[model samples]
Target chain A: MTEHTLAEHTLTATDLRLAYDRREVVHGLSVAVPPGKMTMIVGPNACGKSTLLRGLARLLAPVGGTVELDGRDISTIPGREVATVLGILPQSPAAPEGITVADLVGRGRYPHQGWFRRWTAQDDAAVNEALTATDTIELAARPVAELSGGQRQRVWIAMALAQRTDLLLLDEPTTYLDVAHQVEVLDLLVDLNVTSGTTIVVVLHDLNLACRYADHLIAMRDGAILAEGAPADVVTTDVIERVFGMRSRIIPDPLSGTPMVVPESRHRMENSA
Target chain B: MTAHAVVAGVRRRARLTTLVLAVLAAALLLLALSVGTAVVSLPDVLSTLAGQGSRATDYIVLERRLPRAMTALLVGAAFGLSGAVLQSLLGNPLASPDVIGISAGAGASAVTAIVVFGAAGPPVALAALLGALLTAALMYVLAWRDGVTGYRLVLVGIGLAAILLSVTSYFMTRSQVTSAQDALVWLTGSLNESGLDELVPLAIALTILVPATAISARALDLLAFGDDTASGLGVEVRRTRLALLVCAVALAGTATAAAGPIAFVALLSAPIGRRLARDGGPALLPSALTGAVIVAAADFAAQHAPGLPQVPVGVLTGAIGAPYLLFLLARMNRGGHGG
Candidate 1:
């Protein structure tokens, strides 16, 4: 796989407001995702992590302010042009029934194709490259519906990678996955970022996983950023207590040297105390 | 593989196999054109086609049988293309033009036009189009909440189709016996005869609409991946869907108006086309051709099926289409949430 040199495609929000059905979900939120880095947005459930991710990807329009893509206003950019530079995977990635891994990955070329161009040699090359990168080339012809959760997750990521964009945004990609599958997907993503310098902005629920996988962390509460910095700099017990409303002790991971939080659950420790 | 060696390879063998099948379909179409109710012999049919036959044979070949064959071919093509688009758009096997109430709505409206308004003109096509559009609109409204999901659309279409069919039954019972008999052939679908007057308008509509639909084929393929992903990939989600839905309804409406509601062409053709292509994307032209082949063959079978009272061509399609639907539903049930 030929890794395209990732030019920093900075995504910034200026005083963003987002809502659904006239009810505000995010209010005057502003943040910038530092380009050429893996950034994780972490928060409690319903705290607008997914919504913010959606707004960043331009899948949802901000009710107020502008989302800037690489210094240009995202709303002004043609959707196809925007897609050529930015790709997104929602929480649930739907697969067409009976579609094989290779064919599903090939659909990521939709943004790159014109009406007259059928799949060419280059398209097939990209599909094969994505499959190999995701370690799914052996399962190229297997129907997506028959794959394991971890395998399916890789297939979805491979599809995103097939877009060959500088930036990728994922919304809760590990929601239904087991712990092992979650780690496997996160590891693959890390490899992708390291090898290609692809800017990744992801929403994650597990704080420890977020700290381990992310180079930069954005902690959110009620649609606003609580703190943003390197995992070691931002993922302190005090910050966790404030953002997640849970008392926790912080320690470094033995292997990765990333901040690891050991939550102090009141119910579990009450009898001992 | 060398040039001559590759010619003997599996890929070459597959192509050769399909080429033979395509030739067989062509031959069957020719035989069907010849052996209608009048039983014109193959030699006479061949001579007539070659334009060196008696005036009676020439009249039968060019004027009488040719139009009927053309109607079957065109109507079948429309159904196949429309059904394939609908199935892929709705992302379910059960969602075909006929099963999803588009055809039923057209049939019901055409029946009403004939029975109530005493509409004695070719304007029945207009009524059919109106009925199809209205039915599709109602199905969308009923299915829509946040957005129209595949499961919801099919379920609501089934209910809507049942209601329309009942209304049609009521109208048939109230109409005069002779008009009712004519309505029966129209409802069950027939190609007994069609003048150029009826065939020309349908041909024109198909010509304008089918190509327009092909232009949206890639967009529809993206759509089958589901709404959010399609939109993120730069497909104009609402506009693409509306355009495809309009094309499907128009195709189904036009075919129904031209040939009364023909059976299973829409339902059977798309899956067959998908199988033929052996890929996930909707194969519009191949599906349309399969549809034409199916309807023409079914019409042929209607003439030949012995011991049965002369049934409408649609009866054969229903006999095939209904079981396929059941099989899809059973398979879905068995698979549960795995899909």
Candidate 2:
């Protein structure tokens, strides 16, 4: 695994349970995400990984427990107050029709404005900073719909960054992107964490990339944590087979030396079974 | 140039466009006031406005023309702002008061008041307000089964509006021809001269409602970002939406009650405002002003049209607005896929 360091605020949970339409999605789950670190929550489809992320982001209310953002109950805080501290970028945020990149990014400053307040120099600076940080400065005035998948994803990241919150939660930010674009977004997230000390909590499906890039890895199965710790210490062949319910060959990533999982499919499964 | 200079330039350009539109609207209002069938000259119109004209000029100006002009201004601005706000909020260009049922609701209720109680003496405005509010409330409840999706709300509103419209037609068929003729103006969205007494209240209502809406323009900008994002950005999504809806209903309802469903003011003004503003930003204030200009101008045109008996200002607006609505629909269909 690559060398990594954990940063400080304690994002903790207690007896956190989540449900939809009276059916439980996430069981009693508890975990602490240290501040200023990249934590990736990973699992297969229907494993409640996204549900858990939504619960943590306060988009989904917990059925039985509370998520604590620095010791205070998150739900108890005013919505805007919570927004000022934490920003969540949901998967597939619907863009308003005919909206431009600059206008869309400017919306991220909503929490900072008042009824009478026009966009200030500070707001512009933050918007420009976000655009440059995500390398979308050149496309600032272009309509968001015209951007490629990768560029659009970057524009969304720029929007979230414009919020300027301490903690950023992204649910499958890399979805619908090509592998190259996926790496670019992940690298951008890594750069944000490393440079600005913004705590990044991401829900990613790719186990190998999760292991390679995340400072902390959280492997979940059936809405409960199967493993959580430093990636090198937590990701292993046994953890993969047990948590993922698959037979896999765990090898080092060719570039990063992080543990890479090569799933044994139907052809290989015949001999193993 | 610095970034501030760039932003300033954009703002100044927008301001200039607004100023030009304002001048055009004012010229239209003056022309509307002066050049009617009575054909009062500009000097006579000016003297009448200053309250110092011949008795005949005074009667034409104060008794007939002034009330109609003022009604047009109020109704137009109200319609335009409401349409713009609704369109932006729902992210649909077709989401005008009539299409979404606000005016239909008002029309239906006014017809009911006339048919059932034979309600007279300004009761139409009250009935219209009640109907409009009820429809808005119904639409709100139906669209909120989960969260208010823009498409769901518009669809529900259109359906509800259609139902109210059929009920209105049914009532018309059953009523006496004289009653039907009386109701016809309100039903088709007319501006009869009798509703002038409703003007003071309408003006007062606009004064309160328009400013309140202007204050929430920023929140509306956030709301157009979609509910979750808007909420995440510190907007109380439900509350802000409710507030805006209240303002829109009150503005449209009051104006409709006073002028009997003045057509296209709410539907056409906001979009026209958006185009005139030209920055493509949500042009709330300018939309309101444009609405006023359109209503005033249409009323003028109705009074001045030669070889035809004067139609309700509503008739002329409908004649104009219906085509624009159809044009928009045709344009949408040609695109093969649209909202």
Candidate 3:
């Protein structure tokens, strides 16, 4: 479980053009994921942040450019080979009915198991460690359908963890959760990154949480990068307003010392005026 | 519970359910082989199956009943496995071959051969198989956009099924009475006319297809996660889907060629197998065994059920399975998980 370090692979997309049925979602995008760091992509809806992540994760074939993993073209590599080094948790994956948490997590071992090489102790160990890491060992026997939204999300994370990959990508992992559960999910991801040094990439909707948690932050708008750097450096009032089309005030977080955006709503601005 | 223990428990349960279904299928096979006009005893049937019984018993058990029973078992297993693969691949309980029109396509074509072309026996079976394969190809071509999605495939399949059913009705209405009667019996799915000629092709198909399905079972399971997650997990989503679709079409086609689309065996087997196995994964083996048992038992009842005239096995299955489909629809409607 502890054999692989997450810093070995470099994930980069070079001038990628991604489209869904001729309508380009991401146009001429180039980005390098910082190795061994937690990077969060934040942007308004339909801004193509998720599309870029999908391109980087090799879920979508780029129409124009290439995505490289460890200096190799990702499209040229065998899928299972790529899977061993990278894992992604897509948003809103539907659980098969009556699937136990343990069984669902075990499916993450798919890439590792060959036709002749059936399940082994190593696979069990990976699944067990993933379940234990996510604090879902107790729910192993329970059906995923019966789990609450937070528990279900943790189980999904545990599944991605069970893949035992160096790089992990998640698209809005905290969506549909309440504030507390959102924090819990983010903290769990942070713990995973810190403990295993797994390169973590997330597309998040919450600006404050993204600012607080990301080691590197990227802001996207209209299918292009607006700004990317450390949260303290890139998450300014001007960048926030430009990316989100909203007026906002930037302040340092009291607890984390990260830049926090405080949106200035029309009612609040009028009241102050 | 520990993950290891939980996995072990699920596996144990699935294996136990499969074993139980296997035993039931075996017993039903024996009943199907022995109970007929002669009503051979179990001992006689066993000895005849072992090739040591009297000539009379041998002729009854080995020659006539064996082919029929084998057809029921093989066709049921094929439909079961095919249904399990399609349902898991599509991630929808409603996406069985029967519902999605693969069987209807075969039925329509077979009926056309009988009514319009005056075909009989092997030629009709060949026509059915061709129809099934063509319908599957058509469904895939129509469903494909960026790639085939489960919902789109099912929708296209349902539409095709309706069109094929109308074609079959048109043929039936235009045919001579006796030929139409034969086509109707075949459409309702019967094991009465089974012989080595029909069973051999289906047997050959299963020998190739069943193993192929087993090899792709893992990929099929991953596909239930939707295309994005499945591809992200390293599954070649399009290739895997195409492979599984081919295997499923072949299985359904061969079974239809043998016994004319056995209604609902393909549809009911997977869900029942899943429930009996008490596991989340595709219960392929259990579903196959469950299908064998259902068809064999239904064949037995169709022959021996007191006070009822000898009807085709499909009539009984359609009677039993149609209500279940209604029940499923009601459940889906109430739950709003229509897909």
**Strongest candidate by TM-score:** 3
**TM-score of candidate 2 on Cα atoms, chains taken together:** 0.91
TM-scores, one per candidate: 0.90, 0.91, 0.96
- Per-candidate Cα lDDT values, in order, are 0.83, 0.81, 0.91
Fraction of native Cα-Cα interface contacts (under 8 Å, chains A and B) also present in model 2: 0.36
Q: After superposition, how far is residue B48 of candidate 1 from its true place, in Å?
A: 5.8
Q: Candidate 2 chain A: worst 10 consecutive residues by lDDT?
A: A1-10
Q: Which scores better on TM-score, 2 or 3?
A: 3
Q: Pick the candidate with the highest DockQ.
A: 3
What ranges in model 3 sit over 4 Å off?
Answer: A269-273
Quote the true-contact fraction of every model.
0.48, 0.36, 0.81
Q: For residues B238-331, write the lDDT of model 3, one tens digit per residue.
A: 8999999999888999999999998999999999998999778788899898889899899889889998788899999999999999998999
lDDT of 1 by residue, B146-214 (tens): 667777888999999999999899999999998887777788888765667668888999989988898
Candidate 2 lDDT tens digits, B1-339: 333344455567668767876787777766766776678888888888888999998888778777767777778888888888888877788888888999899999999898867885478789998899999999999888656877888899999999999999999999988888888866766555643687777888888998898887888877776676777776777777788888888888988888878877788888788876654467887888888887777776676767758778888888888999999889989998557
Angstrom error at residue B226, model 2: 2.4
Please, what are the lDDT tens digits per residue for candidate 3 over residues A1-273? 564775889999889999988899998989999999999999999999999988998999999999999999999998888888999999988888788999999999888889633889999999999999999999999999999999999999999999999999999999999999999999999898888889999999999999999999999999999999999999878888899999888888999998989888757476445
* Residue pair clashes in candidate 3: none
lDDT winner between candidates 1 and 3: 3
